[model samples]
Target: MKLLYLSYLNSFKGLSREVWWLALVTLINRAGTMVIPFLSLYLTQDRGFSLEDVGTIMSCFGLGSLAGTWLGGKLTDRIGYYKVMVWSLFLTGVLFIWLQMLESFYAICSGIFVLMVIADSFRPATYVAMSAYSKHENKTRSVTLIRLAINLGFSAGPAIGGVIIASVGYFGLFWIDGVTCLLAALLLLLVLNPKKAKELDQVKNEAPRSAYSDYPYLLFIGAMVLLGLIFVQYFSTVPLFYSEMRSLSEVGIGLLLAMNGFIIFVFEMPLIKYLETSTLSRTSLMIIGLAMTTFSFFFLTIGTWTGLLVIGMILMTLGEMITFPFSSAFAMDRSRSGRQGEYMALYNIAFSISHIFAHNGGMVSIANFGYKSTWYLAMIIGVMGILLLYALRYRLQTSRKK
Candidate 1:
């Protein structure tokens, strides 16, 4: 009944057409993202690889993703966001085709690394483009809209993916994903060409300095890494634990993951609007979110009950809803103008580190310590993130006032 809550629905009214176009492109791309969520299963069950190998291979994807964002930022500053997105999209599709052909372990790892580098380059540019296209007042809502698209797409993706894995096997996922990545590129080409958003975007003429020069931004990046490390376990670790330890089937795992996106799709925007209308600061919001994230993991310490997972996922979804968009908005606000792409790229380093450690360490944790211990670790890290963000409130408040 509350699916069409008026406040959240109203949040969309003032956003620009270009922002919606960007979101449409994201929805298209994410809707096809079947390969990642089920990759651990495909690697272990199909390819006959060990969990250690799977973790290492997934880390390669993380490394490539890291390189892509850095390169995308550099390219965006030089050649522009449009061309950067176009090539990134087109190339990622082509690589997915190439990825399916490679059979050897090393070849698959190397290919996945390359494919991810090409694909993930799209992220920072999208962030840069979204910032450029939205009015300053609508920035948070605009970013939230894009995330809404992403989560909805994700909700559809895994449900469809669950079916695909049963019928056509893992190969279908790559082809479908590749084709849709190209389609998204086409959408970007037609709608987000050189003719758009010249005025709304900040004019970037000056040569940029290193992001390291901003001490507070560096601190922000650290906090971001901590947060990512905590949440990312939901992706790789949670799936593995459910499938291997709890003996849940692939469909069950998919539904659990899909539930995360569904919760975000339904609730995040209204909650964010509520936070905005109140006196809650971005730092305070992140603190509350991290606290929720920590609490979610605590539920996992109970035996692997389906009821507990539903509760845990809802809490984590709420936490993700509050934390991510505002953090991105805060990143844009914190950046010294004209270097938004570079700043966002630096911001994404948190994701890169989390990918490496969460997968690598998480796999190891699951192999050795068991599920309860891993959940305990996530809870501990979440608590640490909350404390760190609370201490950084002064820096964040000062940036907002400027």
Candidate 2:
């Protein structure tokens, strides 16, 4: 046990202090992530909107994400990531506080769309900052560390958010989320300086390349979109599954979701550290992760047993731990010095597209066919993602031989 504890500490040994600060910022921001997870339920139960209306509002979220990420990337390349992140966080906080006031369906949809535009712009900027802060050898682990922070925050967020919702209603969640965002922005201001980030960036010079023109990278992005389409169900639809199909309370559903975050928080870093030393390629590991994610749906289809939910979440979390950090490392490595923001932005946009489809698609599937059918559909998408990853691996191998 002593040796194991030491090894776990060793995993974090080589990272820079800036990376730790970035993780802290992410943790603070994500800790208040209450609204999105419960938005569908709030719209339907509290606001009396139809599932179709909920789907449309969520699609608006996707569209805003697409625009936000693209704009963030462009600005990061031109101005730098620090300014983009600061402004995004501050503006997002202000918008969230205002978001709870809208009563009409169209007003809610428009408000959400604009709010996501300001909020999601932080994503690509954050990725560029990671590249600035991290050394090349530890890049994947660095990404994993940030993910660990996110999961740790998520683990607490839902459990705490569940209680907040129960006591003060959904609007209270908005207030907390807004305040946290403001706090995160302030913390970021105190910690990371843009001039220092430029000094820390290792890649000094390289030819510029357009992410849109990179065919192999675009193929990889496509596979990510498919995987994301399935993965995002946990946030957007799966809670509803726990509430409606399984008859779980809000707290019960929150705990179930929190289980995913807890597993990732405890296990992901050590697992990634071990995987980093292994001989298996990143693509190969991702294929295995995708396979695990596919089977998570299979578990759900087997029965209504609550134990199956736990089992499925464990598998899904393990898969996410394997796939996401490596995927991020791959995206960063593919980027040239001048265009890192663009490449990562395109990478984020892939998931943004998935958000667009996943929320609306999953809801429509559940509403039209039922929960079991939705799980089956997710399984199919997961399989397709695995196959696409294989194709990408083959093309990459062919290019390397040349």
Measured by lDDT, the strongest candidate is: 2
Predictions in order: lDDT:
0.82, 0.87
TM-score of each: 0.87, 0.88
Q: Whole-model lDDT, candidate 2? A: 0.87
lDDT of 1: 0.82
Off by over 4 Å in 1: 1-5, 38-55, 162-172, 197-199, 203-207, 239-256, 302-309, 336-338, 366-371, 397-402
RMSD to true structure for each model, in Å: 3.1, 3.0
After superposing all C-alphas onto the true structure, candidate 1 shows an RMSD in angstroms of 3.1
Worst 10 residues of 2 by lDDT: 195-204
Clashes of 1: 0
